[model samples]
Target: MKLNKYTWIFVGLIAAVYLGILIWVRLTNPVYLQKNMYQTWENSYVMHPKSDQSFVNTSKNNDHQNPVALSESQGYGMLITVRAAQKGWANQKDFDRFVNYWLAHRDYVGDQRQTETYLMSWRQYYNRHHQWVNDINSATDGDVYIAMALALAAKQWPKDATYYRSLAKNLSDDILSYEYNPQTGALTVGDWVTRDSKYWQLMRTSDVMPDIFMTLAKLTGDSRWRTVNNTMLDRLVDLSRLHHTGLVPDFAWITRDAAKPVKPNAISTKYDGDYSANACRVPMMLATSNNPKARKVLKKMLRFFSHQQYITAGYSLSGKRLVKYQSASFSAPIFFAVSHHRGEGYDNLFDSQKYIFSKPLTHKNYYDATLTVMAALEGLN
Candidate 1:
């Protein structure tokens, strides 16, 4: 039957709404498992990055440029295993590989860029060093990854009470110099502002301040850190709610106007719409803590990041456009969120989710392994 003009309009509207809901579910669905902690830990650690036994050198011999596998980004994962250990999560072999890799790479020891070689990480943020580093500490995305690993470790095995404290100092010392705008309450990252850097456009995916400060505060007992962190997170929720769109743009621009609160020039990744990298951390943050507000954010995130393809069980190297991300992103965070959400008493994910992650090692595979270990450890619940 031929549709009249009004009928066509009604059908179009319904189709649009239906598509919107489908996308929403795909973006926010949680990857959860109902199992004991030990079982998940075993599954999570079942396949970690294999050591070439050459400290800092996981690359092949044939290449003239022998790139070291260890970097500050690896520290982003220390949270997983530390949480696992605290929960009595043990798969000694997997745990050992995770720790040994850290032990293998010390430049990542504190998460600061020790050399210019790491400008590459800056490249990850958006191809700029000063912007990513942001004048001294100022919350570089690299530092947060390092801080994340250690903070997660604070509650993990061997109980390094000093570990979290030290890492807190390391990350805090540099980032605190940032101009904390009490008005908008944003801890700016880059040297200036632009459409790409309003929120520190250096990254299309990482939220350096919110997760970093919150993690530091949680790991080291600093309320001030949370103040900065929650501001960003709350602001994020507010913006997304206003849009009525579950998707959180990876970047946005924060303006202080002529009032110019300290460093007034900047732009950030909040403009980016792709959910894969930007959305992974939301559920992980939500799952890791018992905070009421965090739970609320997690609920929204659960609705926002439900698209399962981007939230992989592991990285796929089949020449998929996103796979070339070099970040080795995906399933690791889902498992990490699952691991932590299940709490320190569970462990089935280590084995059950093993098949979802990558094996052997591929282009930039170390980071993927690092993320998986963290997710697995955090999945200790």
Candidate 2:
């Protein structure tokens, strides 16, 4: 029906109000919860800047104190890589020392529920608190080590296919259970079986994601996994591009109100994003194939990783974006990401050899990523 000038004015007003409400929800609701929750290490205006990450002390060793052990039933994927690398480097003694030291401290007892799902590190060391309050975050945690380990195992030693198959399938199922509403473009995780259940946990991109999940998807021949994982990648790109802090929301604070902007907050922990893992995993995803889009993401990750703070022992200097390097943290993933792009091995798939070299040829958590670079280089020919 045709409307008069006054009628049109009223309709426009109503539309403005509706749009305002939508913006409010996206910025303030659960979707935007993270922005207001944790005190960012980079920005303190949002929350009271506490003693969260006051300074940088790379020499500070966390070895003397035994961290809360995570899990023991699994683990050993990277060790195998080390086992293989043992044939090349004489640093076996040094690496094995860490491996054994970690093994001895595996969180085998006390608060068994607090143990992590995969990886030989995080859980076994003291995490103080647990995961986020998002289902997808929880699910991601639920299958981290299992997912990553399986992919590495399959890629490195194919004979272990059966070994990694069941584990990958199980971990994928767990990770998938948290993908209930993928329409919002988010990856969440958490388990909920009892009153003590932490059903939700949210997080931005980390080393434990993308590459591992994508690898699992390929191994299982399940496009669902790839679809969900890629959706995660898309959001990551958005956050990397949009967030003013050069990072993404660390806390999930999920609600029907996500997909909006964030607000200010109070009890801010070290809840900002980190370029280290994001730079590593995003580009790692590109090494498998030659997708032009994936290559772009890979290149972006390289630029990002090159800017982070890496204290000596392969630890993240701060949970925020990479602004400077004050200490000597042995950041190996940086090398690996560069490796894939430079094509370090016999050939060149991603041109990893152009950047990654022996100067910072770290063998820490980067071992897995390095192997990926090698494969990409070999596949190039």
State every prediction's TM-score relative to the real structure: 0.51, 0.48
Q: Model 1, 7-93: lDDT tens per residue? A: 999999999999777545432332322113224433432333355221222234312143333333334434444444555544334
TM-score of 2: 0.48
Q: How does each model score on lDDT?
A: 0.43, 0.37
Angstrom error of the Cα, residue 173, model 1: value is: 2.9
Which numbered prediction scores highest in lDDT against the true structure?
Answer: 1
- Model 2 regions more than 4 Å off: 1-142, 154-160, 178-186, 192-201, 243-292, 301-324, 327-331, 343-381
- The alpha-carbon lDDT assigned to residue 310 of candidate 2 equals 33
- Lowest lDDT 10-mer window, candidate 1? 257-266
